[model samples]
Structure formats: C-alpha cells, structure tokens
Target chain A: MLTEKRNWGWHVLLILIVMAIMLPVLFMISNSFKTLQESYHAILQLIPAKPTFSNYLTLNKQINLLRMVSNTFLMAMIVTLGKVATGLLAAYAFQNFHFKGKRLVYFIFVATIFVPFTTVMIPNYLVIAKMNLLNNVIGVALPQMADATGIMLFIKAMGKIPASLTESAKVDGIPNRKIFMNLIIPLLKPSIISVGAIFFINSWNEYVWPTLVLKDKSSFTLPLALQNYISSEGGTNFPLAMALAVIMIVPPLLIYMIFQRYILNSISTSGLK
Target chain B: MLNNNSQIEEAVNSRYGPRASRKPRRRLLPFLYLLPSALLLLVFMIIPIGYTFYLSFFNWNLIAPTKEFVGLANYVNVFTDPTNQKVILNTLVYIVLLVILNFILPYFISLIVNFFIGKMKGPYKILFFIPSLFSLVVGAMLFSWILNPVSGPLALFLRDFGMKVPQWTNSGAMAIVVICLITNWKVFGYNFILLLTGLGAVPKNILDAAALDGVPKWRVIWNIVLPLNRGVAIYVFILTIVQGLQYVFTPINVITQGGPYYGSSNLLYHTYLNAFVLYKTGNASALATVTFVIFLILLFIEIKFVEGRHKDAD
Candidate 1:
C-alpha cells in the first residue's frame, strides 16, 4: 500500500516536470494563432480566445518566409550530401585499408571535434571573403560541410561490419570500388540514414556561421531571417515573431519526430564506443 | 580443397614476386579514398586553425591593406581587459551550471523515469525531447517571448500567483541564469536519453541480487548503477564543456547580445563581438586561440581518462 502511494506520487511529479518542459513550445504555438491584442493580453491562457491566422499572413507580407525556408532546405541538403560522401569515403579508407600513418591521420580527424568552430571563425570568414563567396549560400554551407562527428560516427559503424565479408569479395577478384559500392554501401543503409538525418537537421538549424557569411536579405536562411525579423520588428509584432518561430521550428521538429529512435541510437552508440 | 587453394595462391604470389606487384597499386588506393576528406579537412579545418594561430600575433582589421605584427599584445589585452574578464567568468559559470543541469540532473531524471514510469517511458521521452527539436534561434525566441515582462506567459503566471517576475534581460546575472535555464531545458532530454541507454546496459541480474541482499535502492543506484556507467558519465561531462561554448552562443546573440553589460557573454560570443561588431580580427583570433587551448586540455583529459578506461574494458 505504501509502495503504491509512493509510485503515484512519482507519477504526479514526472507529469508536472513534463508539463514544465512542454510549456514554452505550447506557448509559442498558441500565441502564433492569437491576434496582437489577444497575445499581449491573454498571455496566461493556454488557448487563444479567438484564434486567427493574421500573424502568419502578416509575416508573409513583411518577409519572404517561403524563400528563407527554401534557402535553408537547399543549404541543408547540399551540406548533408557533402558530409555523407566525405564521411563514407574516409570511413571506408580507415576501416578497410592498411596504410602507413593511418593511425595518425585518424587521430587528427577525430581531434578536429575538439577544435570548436568559434576558434577558427575569423580565419574561415577571411577565406570565404577572399574567394568572393560572401553573401552566397555556398559559402555559408561550405565551411560546415567538413564534419568530424559524421566521419567518426561512420567509422564506428563501418568497424562493426565483419572483415571476412570484404575479404571474401576481394578473393573473388571484385574491385575495391565495386565492393564498396555494391556490397558495403547496401549494408550501411541504417548508418547512412541516421547520419544523414543528423547532418540534415544540424545544417538546417545552423545560425551563427550563416549570419556571418550571408548579408543579403534574399540569401537569408530561416534562422537568420527569423533573428532579423525578431530583433527589428518583433517588439510590437509578437504574434508575427511567434509565427516565424513556428515556421523555423517545423522542419527540424518533423525530422526529429520521425527519426528520434535513430538519433538516440546514434548518440549512445557513438558515445559508448 | 584447402591445400589446393593454398598451392594456387602460393603459385600466383610467387609469380607476382611475393605480392609486391599487387601491393604497390593497392597502397595508393587507400590514400585515394582518403584524399577528398583530407583535402577538405586540411583546407577548412586544419589550415584555418593554423591561420587563426598566426593571426593572433598581428593587429589587423580584415579590410586593412596591411597587418602590423604585435607579438603577444593581443593576448595581453585579452587577459587585462575588464570586460573580457567578465566574459571569462560568465563562461566558467555556464560550464559549471551546465555540468549540474545538463549532466547531473539528466542522469538522475533518466534513472527515475526508467525506474518508476514503466510503460510511459517512450512517450515521456518524446515529450521531453520536443524542445530540443527546434533550432537554437527559434528556441531562444520562444523563450524570449515567454519571458517578456508584459506579454510573456511566465510573467502572467507569476502575476497570477502573486509573485514578481524580474526583468530577465536587463539584469546581468539573471540574464545569464535564464539563458542557462533555457539551454538546460532544451538539452537535458538529449542527455537523459543518452543516460537511459547507458543505464539499460547495467546488468539486471546484479540489481536483483543487490535487492535480494537487502541493499537499499539508493545504495544500488549510487554504488552499482553509477559506477557501471562511468563511461557515459564522463562522456556527458566532456560534451557539456564542448557544447557549453556552442550552446550559449545563440541565446546570447539573439536575446542579450552578450549583455546589459557584457555579463552573459562567454568566450565564443566575445570572439564574435571582437571580430564582427568591433572589427578587431587580431584580438578575436587571440581570444579564440586561448579558448582553443583550454578545450584542447579538456579533450586531452577526456581521452586519457575516460576513453582510456573504455578501451581497457573493451
């Protein structure tokens, strides 16, 4: 009887914590549907008294929300593809082949994770400027494409494949490239999916670098666009800013919902290994 | 069949001069496979890091035609500046708070959820992790809206409860605390899930045995569950440090711009302010170098301590 009572108490506590965690997200979505007056005055209400689409409509008129979303999508896709390709090639080399300085090279690549991007932000900006890629989405995406975490995760996944599978193919006179493409690539579907999703979400959500590189309004990614909107116009336009925030969040949230299992798996597997 | 195959392989190898003919081409193949990533990393990561180090010794505005070398003056300036000192203190506080909230709190939360919430674990996890799904800028914006004095739900709730909600942004220490709170809210679920995975690996039989031996639940957790998952704990620690720098960047930029008086700014934000806002490339590079060295030491410790134990266990 005492244990049952204690269990119920724990349940109540957990539910309360969950509500606190969900509160901001719920508030943002709720306010996005409110009118300016309702948002300002009905702040304590969970649901808007009179829900309206005016905030979103106003946002559409003031800024190119569609363009910003598309820009983010394009940059994310390109960067994800680049990182996956580079990660796969490097992982295959590290796992399948034996070469001098292999250990040193792998160590160096892994060590890059420790060097936070902020440390090299200035120099990278200079390089991008020199190449005349400033204000270009390509410049915003290029520096971030070389990801150490993606490569390391791919290496870990590749290590799990049995050596005999590759060796038997080699003995049958299959070319290395063919083996990698026809045999190994198919086996690595799960890792590819998880890693690609991570890359996509990360690139989609990237802010500081894009903010630094892209100055043109047309070139603004979603996060940058949202930041500009909020800082300049968000004071009086709370509902509209909330709407932009909702738009900015939807893609990543969708991806997260769909791939939560893979993401969690990837984190644990990479960390524990 | 095995003997015949071995004889055939020996004959082929002998004809090819003990594998040398095939080995030379294959030796280059690995490098070919590695070249793309290596070149990109060299250009983007390795070379830039070296250049950042080089730039730290000179004084230059990025647009200037000439950069004058000043040796360690930039480093001295970083150390002596009062504003920079506050930034350093903010960063240290952020890291310490993150270790408590992000690492320690999540570990315990995972344990409770795993232990008590039997069937609701999946749904609870998804709910908790929802905040992290949003982009950092979006998350910060949402919090800023919620913390707005006039229109924020938080203020309204506090007012209803007859409590005063302070002006979070205008206050220096409170601003940093609020940013940390927002960060922890967004991130704790991620670490919780990671810790749950770690906890799942703890042997059930041992727990049962401990229970059978009359070991208290707290004792079982403190002695067995924690020690068994030290690897994950250490990983969580290192991640907190690394991410502490990155995570606060967005919030500070969006919400506070590093201050009512530079109280919320950390090393990363300071680097940005120096480089972009002030156009002091050299000073920014010097600060970056210092931050880089500090993390390098932390990373080295992680490798030596945590990863070393991991390998031994494997």
Candidate 2:
C-alpha cells in the first residue's frame, strides 16, 4: 500500500512538473485562437469560444512576416556557413599541425569567450559603421562568422579523428591544404552539421546586435521585427501578437525537427563531455 | 611518433625543395590559420576591452563629446554611490537565486524523467525543451500575462477564493524576485536536458554493483550518480553565472524598466542605460570593468575547483 502510494505521488509530481513546463506554450497557442474581446475579457477561458483567423491574417498583412522570415533565414545561413568553413579550417590546423604559439593562439581564442558582447557592442558598432556595413545582412553575419564555440567544438571533434589518417595522407604526398579539404572536412561532417544547426538557430534568434545596428525596416530580422511590432502596433492586441509569435517560432521549429537527430547527438555529446 | 622535430623535418624536406625552404612555411601555417580570428579579436574583442578601460578613465558622454580624462573619478563614483551599490547587491542576489534554482530544479526533473526513459523520452524531452527555444521578449510577454494581478490565471483563482491577488510587478523587490522565477522557469528544461545526459553517462555496471551490495536506490544516486556527474554540475554553474549576468538586461528592460525606481537594475542594463540612454559612457565603462572583474574571479574559482577535483579523482 505504501509503495503504491509512493508511486502515485511520483507520477502526480511528474505530471505537474510537465504541466508547469508546458503551460505557457499551450496558453500562447490557445490565445492565438482567441478573439480580442475574448482575450481581454476578465474571465480566463481554456478554450476560445469564438475562434478566428483574423489575428493571423492581420499578422500576415500588417507585419512584413515573410520578408522577416527570409531575411533571418538568409543571414543565419550565411553566418552558419562562414563559421563552419572557418571553424573547420582552424580546428584542422590545431589538431594535425604543430607550430609555435599554437597553445597561445588557442588560449587567446578561448579567452575571447570571457569578453561579454556588451563590452564590444560600442566598438563593434563603430567598426561596422566604419566599414559602411550597418543596416546590411553582412553586418549581422560578420561578427558571428568566427564564433569561439564553433572553433572549440571543431577542435574537439577533430582531435577525436585519429592522427593515423592524416599521417597516411601525408605519406601519399597529399598537400596540407588537400588533407584539410579531402580528409579532415569529411571526418568532421557530424560536428559541422551540429555546429551549423546551433549557429543557425542562434543567429536566427539574435536580437540585441541587430536591434542596435539595423535601422532599416526592409532589412529587419524576425526577432527585431516581432519586437517592433509588439511594442508599437501590436500593443494590447495580445491575440495578434501571439499569432506573430507563432509565425516567428515556426521556421526554427521546423528546422529543429528536421535536424533533430544530429541535434540530439551533438547536444548529448557536447553537454556530457 | 612525430611528437618531435624529425617527422616534421622529413615531411618538410619531402614537401619543398629542401628542409631550409620548408622551415618558414611550417612556422607560418599555424599563425596563418589563426590570423583571421586573432585580427578579429584584436579589432573587435581586445581593443574594445581596452577602449572600455580608456573610456572609464574619462568623462566620456555620447551627448557631449568633449572627452576629458577624470582618472579614477567614475570608478570612485560607481563604488561610492549608494544607488550603484544597491544595483550591485541586487545583481549578486539575483545571480545567487538564479544559480540555486537553475541547478536544483533541473537536477530533480532529470532524475524524475530518467525513471521512465525508454519509450516516451524523446517527445517528453522536446516538450520540455520547447520553452527555452522561445525568445526572451515572447517569454517575458507571455509570463507578464500569466502573472497579471487582476485577470491572469493566478489572480482569477485567487479572486474566486476570496483572497486578494498581490500585484507582483508593482513593488520593486517582488518584481525582481518574480523576474528570477520566470527566468528560472524558462531555462529549467535546458538544464534538465543537460543533466539527463550527464546522468546517462554514468556506467550501468556501477549502479548494478551498488544494488547488489544492498545499497538503496537513493544511496546509489547520492554516492555513485552525483559524484560521477560533477562535470555537468561545474558546466551548469559556470553557464548559469554568465547567463544570469547577461539576462538581467531582459527583465530589467521588459518587465520593470529597471523598476518602480531603479530597484531591479542590475549591472549590464545599468551600463547600457548609462552608455546609450543617459550618455555616461565613462560610468558605463567603469561599471562594465567591475562586473567583468567579478565574473573573471568567479570563473577562476570554478576552474580551480573543477581542476583540483579532477586531478584528485584521476
């Protein structure tokens, strides 16, 4: 009897915990279906009595929703591709090649992680302005192109690649560049894919830097666009804003699901190790 | 094993006309690989830190561009001012509460989830992890409604029970605490996922051995699982500390706007306000330096502890 009660208690707590975790998301989805009048009503209703697509339709027409989605997608892809290419190259060098200042350079790069974005935001803005890159997708992509996290992941992934393969390639008169291109890159495919997914998601969701740099409405990323919409036009229109939220969330969610197998593998390995 | 010069020399001679011709190339490849990141660090990362230090020493303002060096003036003002001190204290309290909740809540959630792992874990993990995938603006906005004093779910429940629903965001102190709760709630799934991975890394044989020795399941968790997953604990703590500092900006900006009065103002948002809004670049730089130093010390301590324990275990 006592054991049964304990089991029941555990199951109840687990369900409650899961509910607590999911309640907000469920509420947001439900609210998206709610009418403005219904949402603003004093009573909280789990189910919307009058479901409508007006909020969603308004979201599509009023906000440049598709443009923001494409803009975010393009920028994230550019940044992800740049990081993978550069990160893989650097990691291959560190793993297979030995030279002076290797440890020092690696340490310097790792140390970059400590310097918070706020410290660099002012100067980064200045640098971007000097390059005439402000209000451009390239501006958003440049700083993220060589992230330390990708480099670290690549280095760790490449380290796990056996040295025998590189030695064998060298014995066959393979050039250093060729070895990196043909051998190291292939071996690090999983790492590249995983890091690319993470980088893409991060870039897609990035807000502050874009908020600071991009002043053009046409060039606005999804998060920035949604934020602007919420603060300005969508204020007090919780249903419409929730619809916008749903729209902003869908692409990343789709991308996440597509690459979920790699993501889970990478996350489990990266987190545990 | 070419852990020495001979293999490199042989490769050098084979690659180029001679060993002498190859020397510079060998010396150059590593630097060449690092050049882009190093230059980026110099221009964007390192110089910015130096510029922050320089700005802190001057009476720099965005509005008034007459930069005058004030030596230790901003630093002195930041340290000596009561309001600045309160912000620092509040930031520390916020971080401590965040670290505690982020570390503990997720650990148990992972523990509970591990009980029913095989069939439903994938969907369960995704369900739990989805909240973290939302942007801070959305999360904060959603929670703001959830915590609304009048018509929110909580308030409505209280109203039916004939109890007054306290306005959480109206008061400064409670506002900060509620922000921390919301922050923790949003992030708990991420840590839970991480902890589950750590728990999965524990060898099954060790648990089996403990069970055969008649050790209770609780003891097995305490003695075997917890000790082995120390790395996850360290990682979680370090990440929580850094994220905790960075995230104070979101709550400060969105929920309170740094207060009913500057009550919930943590260091980062305060620095931002000083830099852009109020145009006290000097004060902002000084504040950034102090916060950076505090973070560096904490990171150093965490590294030392982890390394010491690791070495002892090995």
Candidate 3:
C-alpha cells in the first residue's frame, strides 16, 4: 500500500527531484542541435534558437562517424555473441558433467571476475600489438570474449532448473542431445536475454580497452571518436564533440528505456546470486 | 511420494542398461565444452598477471630493444615515489567519497522514494536511472564542458546569482570531488535501483507488525531493514570500491589528466600514465602488481564469506 501522507507536497518534491536529474540530459540533447558559432556565442543556452545539423556534419568531416559507429556496433555484437556462447557452454558443462578438475576449472573461470582488467591490461596490450591488431576492432573485443560474471549467472540460472526435468526426459527415452536442446535451452531463454542485453550494453559503452587498441580515427569506437581530438580544440570542436556524444548516448539510453526491467532485474539478481 | 528417489535412481541406472557395464562415455566431452573459455582465460588473464610481475623486475621502455636486470628497483621507486604516495592516499579518499556518494546517499534516496514519498516511484526510478545509461566518457565530457570553471554554462548560470564556481581542476581535492560527482551521477541510480530492491525485499508484514506495536520508523529500519538487506548492501559496497576507481578513470583522463600536480590521479590512472604516457613499463608493472594484490585479498574474503553462506543454506 502507498503511504498515508501522500500530500501535494510529495508530488511537487518528486517533480523537482526528477527535473534536477533530468536537466543536464535535456541540456545535452538541446545543445547537440546548436551550430558551432551559436554554441560559442551562448554557452548557457539550453535550446538553440536557430538549430542546425552543421555540428553533426562537422563531426563526420572531422572523424568518420559512420564508419566508427558501425565498427563500434559490430564490436559490441561480436563481444556479446562470444560471451554468451562461451559462458553458456561452460555453464552447461559445469552443471551436468562429473569431470575431474571441475571445481578447479570453475574456480579459475569465476576467479577471473575479481581480476580487474587494469592489472593484466599491459600484457594484453603487448600481446595484441604483437598480433599486429592494434587498430583492429577484433583486437579490442578479443580479450573480453569470456565474461566470468556471465558464466556465473548462467550457472545460477541453470542450477534453478529442476534436475528431475532432465532425468524425466532421460527416462522417457529422450536422447541427451535432444533433452538439452528441447528442455534445457528453452528453460534458459530468459537468462540468455538478460545476459545478452547486459553484455551488449557493456560492450557498447566500453571505453578503456578500446581506447588502448583502436588508435585510428576510421577504426575508432564511438567513445574514442568522441574523445579523439577533444584536448586540442577550437570553437568548432566542442559542438562537434557534443553531437558525437549525443549519437553515442542515444542507443544505450533507448536500450535502457525499453528493456530496463530486464537490465535492472538481472543486475539485482546477479549481484545477490 | 517425494521419497521416490530410489525408484528414480533405479530407472536411471537401469535405463542406461546395467550400471556396472556402463563406461564413462565421451569422457572428454565436458572438457571440449569448457575449452573455448579456458583458453581465453589462460592467454588473456592468467598469463598476463605473471607477465606483468616479470616485467616489474626489468627496466625497459616499451620500445627499447634491451631490458636491464633491475631487481627491486621498480618496486622501490614505486613505493618511494611521492606522487605515487599521494595517489595511494587519493585511493582511500576515493573509497570514502565514492561510498558516500554512490552507496549511502543512494540508500536514503531509495528509502525516501520507496517508504517516505511513496508516489510515482516507478517514474521516479526510470528518470533517475536515465543518467546511468549513458557512457562514463559522455558523462565526463558533459560535466567537463558544463563545469569548465570559466565561460561554461554552469559558471555563467551561477554568475547571474553573483556566485562564482570554483576552477575544480586547479585544486587536487576539488578535482577528485568533481570527478567523483561525475561518477556518482552515472552510477547513483543504478545503485539506487539495486539498493531499493534490497530495501523493498524486507518483509512488509514485519514492518506492519512493528507499526502496530508503535515501534518508531528508525528502530525498524535500523534493527530490521538494514540486517535483511546486509547482503546486498555489502555487494554494493564492494562494487563501489572495486569499480568506482575505474569509473573515475574516464573523468580523470578527460578533465584533469591527473593534473594540478597529480592531485586527482588514483593508482589505476597513475599506472596508465606511467605505462602509456611516460612509457615507464617497469614502474607501471610494479604499480599494477600492487593493485592486483589488494583486489585479490578482497576477492578471497568474498569467496570465504559467500562459501560460508552457501554451506549454511545446504
């Protein structure tokens, strides 16, 4: 039940709170439409009186926005696919198999979750450079292929699947492969979406690794493109930077807005699990 | 009826046709399934840690063809460096600031929305969550442009009220605070949602019964809600300490570059600077080793705590 003292004061207070959080975002969206000259002339203007697409055009001129955006999206998709596939298989193996060294293998995989990427980042960079893939999107995505948290999540989701369901299928003369295909995979469908969406967003928003790997403007991820020439700036660059940031931010925001329940629920569930 | 385990076992055993005759078929199957992830872990994570430690003992700029045997020199320098000392101190400061901004403040914010205000909770949550969806880089850039200390929108906005905004980059302490706020904005709502879920999971009946007994709200929240939500609260706590430093890395790079005499730099950003900016691979490796050890200790404690809980449930 709702609180008894839900007075008019509460609604007003809530709206004010919402606006405080939202105004900066509104500020970002509004400024993305401004021209460089207008942006410089009125830095405090939330809404550009004469909005123009010139900033976005300059963004493309300065950096290959189309190419970078596509590359970033492709990188996200590849990493997400790799994580889900590897994590699913690994989780399934741990759930069903009586193999020797199972606990040790599981421990090794899960322990990597605690291994912050910063520590191993240098060596990983060296290896990638050695592979001559410094500016490659695959190089950026390669080391991030196996997400330990995703494996752990899948394992937890799988553990919740009743063992008797698999056993019943076995007694009914269903083959092991068929049982896995029809029963196990279907039951894991919800978790698959949860992990997949999480992985996609994470990979999409990833910056540090890509910053290290993707050096060329053409190969730059969205984050890289936004930050590429930020330091050495003139009047034109800030508006262009704002345009790139707006482009970079929209998809993830849309993803969050549409599938927030899945994203948020998965986080709470995975954190506790 | 539930004790039909023996019969089910018999059926499974017999269905495979004589357990004694059964062999470990496809014994390598599970290994095959686990291969892709294991190899990635070995090459990417396990080997790199060992490699970083090995590099710490050598003096070599990344491009230099030769590496001199400088045993313990990098470690000594990393330990003795005044800038590193400040950064080490800055890390603790980061943890305190981050926990307050990202963890504790969000706890009360959620508490108000869930228990106090009680209206438009869903809409409020979605709006709050909006900031978290954007990349930390975007957030840092946005804040950097807005809070540029001169001619930025915020400075201009405040000028109308005869107020002056601090040039945050000029002071180390202020820079750290500003960067933390950038992180807090991006992370606050996500933590809010996680914590609110935890707070909401406290059984409503318990609170209702306490209300009937005329038990004060603080007593119920203090004695009851906090304990029930302890697991999640701890989860967010560890997350803040572990991931918070990383989140600040973007802003630190974009805004300050660990500037104003390295005031805003943490160990992670410092390590990045030493390795990439200065190409002091040895020093960075040593620093990275130190970071690895601290986090490992935390992870082990977590493993022990979680294992104990699982044992209790079993």
Best by TM-score: 1
Residue B237 lDDT in candidate 2: 78
Summarize candidate 2's per-residue lDDT along B1-314 as a digit string, tens digits. 32454467567678776646656776787766767666666777888888887788988775464889899999998989887898888888888888888877788778766653333467667766666666666766676667776556677778778886677666778878877776776677777788888888778898778778888777788877888888777777777778766765665576677776678888877888788788888898899888778777766766676676577467
Candidate 1, residues B1-314, lDDT tens digits: the string is 54684476567778886556467768888998888789888888899999999999999988899999999999999889999888888888889888888898888888888765566688777777777667777777777777777666777778878876677777778888888887888788778877888888888899889888988888999998888888777877898879867888988888889988887889999999999999999999999999999989988888876766677567
Candidate 1: how close is chain B to the reference, as a TM-score? 0.90
Q: Which lDDT tens digits does candidate 3 get at residues B1-314?
A: 22373365467678776544224534766876788888888889999999999999998888899988899999898779899999999989999999999999888877777777655688877788888778888887777777766657888789889998886778999989989999998888888888888777778999899988988777888898887777677777777888898889988887788978988899999999998999999999999999889888877777766565456445
| Model 1 chain B weakest 10-residue run by lDDT | B1-10
CAPRI grade, predicted model 3: medium
| Top-scoring candidate (lDDT) | 1
Residue pairs with backbone overlap in model 2: none
How well is each residue in A1-273 modelled by candidate 3, as lDDT tens digits?
335665456668767767767787787777889876777677667878998898788777767778888998999999999999888878888987788888888888888887777788899999999999899988999988846888898898999999988878767866455566678889998888878887988899888899889877778888877766466122325677778888988888778767887777777776664
- Which sections of candidate 1 miss by over 4 Å? A1-5, A232-236, B1-21, B311-314
Off by over 4 Å in 3: A1-3, A6-14, A40-47, A172-176, A232-236, B1-22, B304-314
Please give the DockQ score of every candidate, comma-separated: 0.61, 0.45, 0.56
Candidate 1 docks with a DockQ of 0.61
**Ranking of predictions according to TM-score:** 1, 3, 2
Tens digits of lDDT, candidate 1, A129-226? 99999988889989998667887998888888999999999999776777888888899988898889889988898887898999999999988877
Model 3, C-alpha of A31: deviation from truth (Å): 0.7
Q: After superposition, how far is residue A179 of candidate 2 from its true place, in Å?
A: 1.8
TM-score of decoy 2: 0.90
